[model samples]
Target: MVAITDKEFKQLTEYIKVNYGIHLKEEKLMLLTGRLQKVLQQEGFNNFTDYYHHILNDQTGQAVVTLVDKITTNHTFFMREADHFYFFRDRVLPFLANTVQDKDLRIWCAASSTGEEPYTLAMVIDEFFGKDKVFWDTKLLATDISSQVLDIAKKGIYSNEKIAPLPKHWKTNYFKKHDNENSVLIDKIRNEVIYRKFNLMDTTLPFKKKFYTIFCRNVMIYFDYKTKIELVNRLYHHMEYGGYLFIGHSESLTKEFTKFKYIMPAIYRKE
Candidate 1:
């Protein structure tokens, strides 16, 4: 096993945070080592330092993307936070319907890895307004830094085993069979969603229109204090005046001076 020396660990994590705004902790050493060994061998680097130096200059972003994919935790599920969805349906959606006169609604599934979270959001929206109402104007913009995952998300395919837990009617409503095997979202729903590659660390949000609600859940736990505050503030700036932010159940905004205030547990609305 190729172990990361303490110095190598420091250098690599520093590079990641500076370039990508990700903070690796002491406990991630084992995980990093496990993920990087294959990468190091592929790069023909004998030790950690050589791999670090080589990748630091890898501006094409391929190497860095792989590094990010390995280190970041992307564990999530459809309707994982059941309460948030119910709350949105009962509270936020009506408020949105009343206030936002425009039929066009923009939703950013900011950390939309492997497609589950954004697809789940699309399902909820489709359920509420039906396909005829939401099929055109309300776009679900799903983004992540990993091109690998974006491809999967864009394809909109999932194993039968993976999507098994979804309600049977929902599975029938949103998805179609793939090669008589796995499940994939129908073209109507799939087309409504736009999947793109985005690096959250970037200071500028690329979209021309501000988002109405941003689900950046579970992505920020990797960030240290400095990066977390900076990213949160930037997200706040990109949101609409009354926009809502949903972080992980484990994430908090009380530590920051952001104008966002708590709405329900783990849900915050912009002031």
Candidate 2:
């Protein structure tokens, strides 16, 4: 087992947080050491310090991009947390569909990891509006810290296993067999989502307008308290009045954010 001392640990932690919004805890050095060792070795670097030096010296930042890609937890699938979609359909969508002027609905899937979550949202929107009544402006901004994942997401293809939990109707209706093993998101639904790279630490976001719903789920568990607080506040500011925030089942904004009233768990509304 490779041991991580304080010096190498600090270097990598700063590198990760600076490049990706993920803040590594002191206890997580083991995790960093283990997960990153292979990346370093694969690149012919001896250790984290060498890797850090390489990234620091690379002005073009392709090295940092690769490191962020290697470190980001992009493991996700379509229709994850069926209950959230249930909440969206039963609780959230009806409100947006009826109350919001025009049939346009905008959902931002922050930290959209490999496109599963946003694609799932698009599928649910498709179901709600029916296949024929598809409104053109029903869009989703699928953003992640890793450009590499966003690139893959923009292609809108997934293995059958990645979409295993989709209902039979959705599986047949929303996707087509790309080959013997994978499925591609049908053109209509895939076109509704726009994939882009974003950093959570940036004080200003790229969006000119706010969204009706934002899903930043499962991405905050790695951040420190200060970073978490800043991110939560920034997300709060980005939402329109009555916009809904859905986070991971394991995450909560209770520690730092008091503006949001906890709606269930992993769900909050700007109040």
Candidate 3:
């Protein structure tokens, strides 16, 4: 393995936290080294400092992309959080469908790791709207910082294990066999989600229209309290009044740092 010195680890962690909002602690030194050792070996870089310099000096941005991909974990599956989807379908969708007169539903899966969450949302929307779905604009925006995961999300294929948590009807309605061991989401469901490579740390969020619901789940645990609060505030401004935000169940937001009304354990409203 390529050994990273204390100085090198600090340099890399600071760069990541400043640019990507991911706070790496000293304990993650081994993990960081393990994940990047092969990349360093292949690139002919003997030390983390040289690799860091290469990343900084690379104008194409691919180095940074690869670094982020290596350091981040993108493990997700269909209907990973069942209750949130239930609430979205039963409570959130009904409210939006009734209140929004324009018939345009804007939804964003902000940390869409490998496409399961957004696709699940699309399926829920389709099932809820049923035949009337043709009349509304329900296309979803799914974003992730890692291009590698975004590419996997775009393909919309999953193994049987990944697809297991979904409802049976969903299996029949939304997916088709990819081979003996996997299935791919039908284009109808796949097309409903638009994937983009987005870093939540960007100072300015680029969106012309505010979203009704944003699912930024499970990724914020990497950020420190300050970064988390700042991102929460940014998301608040990008959402419509009375919009809902669903974060990871393991995460929480206190009233002291954010204005979002706590609706439940992991859900908030921009009321």
lDDT per residue, candidate 2, 103-190, as tens digits? 6577899899888899899888888878544553788888887888888889889999878888989889989999999999999889
- Candidate achieving the largest TM-score: 3
Candidate 2 TM-score, C-alpha based:
0.91
For model 3, what is the error of residue 95's alpha carbon versus the real structure, in angstroms, after optimal superposition?
Answer: 0.3
Worst lDDT window (10 residues) for model 1? 130-139
TM-scores, all candidates, are 0.93, 0.91, 0.99
Model 2 C-alpha RMSD vs. true structure (Å) is: 2.1
- lDDT of the candidates, in the order given: 0.82, 0.82, 0.93
Model 2 clashes, total count: 0
Worst 10 residues of 3 by lDDT: 73-82
lDDT, candidate 1, 138-182, per-residue tens: 678998887778887889898887788788998998888886668
Clash count in backbone of candidate 3: 0
Off by over 4 Å in 1: 131-136, 179-181
